[model samples]
Target: MADDGPDEAGEPEGPDGAAGQPVTPDRLRAFSDGVFAIAATLLILEVKAPAADERVWHALRHEWPALAAYAVTFLVIGIAWIHHHNLFHQVRTVDRGMLLLNLGMLATISFLPLPTATLGGHLRGGDASAAAVFYSVSMAAASAWFTLFWHHLCRRPQLMLPAAREGASRARRNSLLGPVGYAAAALIAPLTPEGSLALSAALVVYFVVGRRAPATRTRVLAE
Candidate 1:
């Protein structure tokens, strides 16, 4: 009934105004959030009660290692979801590169439970250090993937809203802190597991306290 097509007569869409295919990152953000939520929820599976025994309390106490692992990983994933929410809030569009990067990050996020299982099961064994190392290293890899995701956005200034670009460098630096902290923890795991975990907790504190709200955000792409 009506001709619906690109408006050649009007200026381009988006804040950058240099358009290819205008898009909204809403779906990507939503899917990523789902993955994060599922991963966080599944962290608890690492914790299990001891075998059927009359000393129920005593048996449950043996699961403290798993419970500890669950706590750390849960907080880590929870923090990740919050940061991912903030990151996407600045994005208005998605492209092939962005989509691939997002998928890579999500893949690692979804696989987090595997390593969580390993860490929790072995935390009190001879391989405790090894388990901690694996957990920290895996998280470091996830952190790196997330950094690459942000770098993809930084490379394409047009994908983000105007205000986001201005503070992009600062945001990028803040995002790396988690990876750096994880890497450091990985190295320190062999020496002192508690110290390594303490570092991880410190990094979480930094993220929680240092994060700033996005200056502005835009609606999804209508196209």
Candidate 2:
């Protein structure tokens, strides 16, 4: 009978004294990056070009709402991608639960452009309140999913690298701000559509400039 022993590096061997199947976050990160890239690209499609018969400059001038919405949504997604990258930097492996939770997050990301278009279409119309509320709610949903994702990682410390553990508690606390801020924006939408939009933009700025995370080296676990 063969002895089951630790390898030369002193890591315990798996079945047959061989290394276990490697479970790394690389594939998950790749898929997420693709989704983020596609979602960002799709936001541009919401900003349509001027009609052929319309005066180009005049039509573009009137499309300011759409243009503005596109820029804001682009920023939202860009910040989301950056945060996602940062979060995954702490992750060493992914399990089934993590995969499902990540899918929920990506679903919200993919859905943002629809509400963005709706908000842009109605921002100057009588239904601005409805459009703005819908957009705010969508943003809140995305933030909620992100909050849940972070909490999941906090709960499952084994999924994270040892070096990353020190920051997990702070990261979990900070995650709550997203859902709360977006929910506040949603609640205020009925009173002031423009204010809701401004609040949403403000949240993006805060995330970008105020909540910067320290850079971490990506450490992959050996197979």
* lDDT leader: 2
lDDT against the true structure, per candidate, is 0.72, 0.79
Alpha-carbon RMSD of each model:
7.5, 6.5
Model 2 misplaced stretches (Cα beyond 4 Å): 1-23, 213-223
lDDT string for model 1 (1-223, tens) is 1112233211235667555453356677777888898888888776775676548788778887677777777877877776677777777666666667778888888888988788778877888788788888888878786678677777777767776787777667767877888999999989877677667777766665654422222233232
Q: Give the TM-score of each candidate.
A: 0.80, 0.83
Candidate 1: clashing pairs of residues: none
Please name the candidate that would achieve the greatest TM-score relative to the true structure. Answer: 2
Compose the digit string of candidate 2's lDDT tens values, residues 62-175: 988888888888988887887787777778767666777789999999999999999899999999999999998898898787677777778777777887877788778877
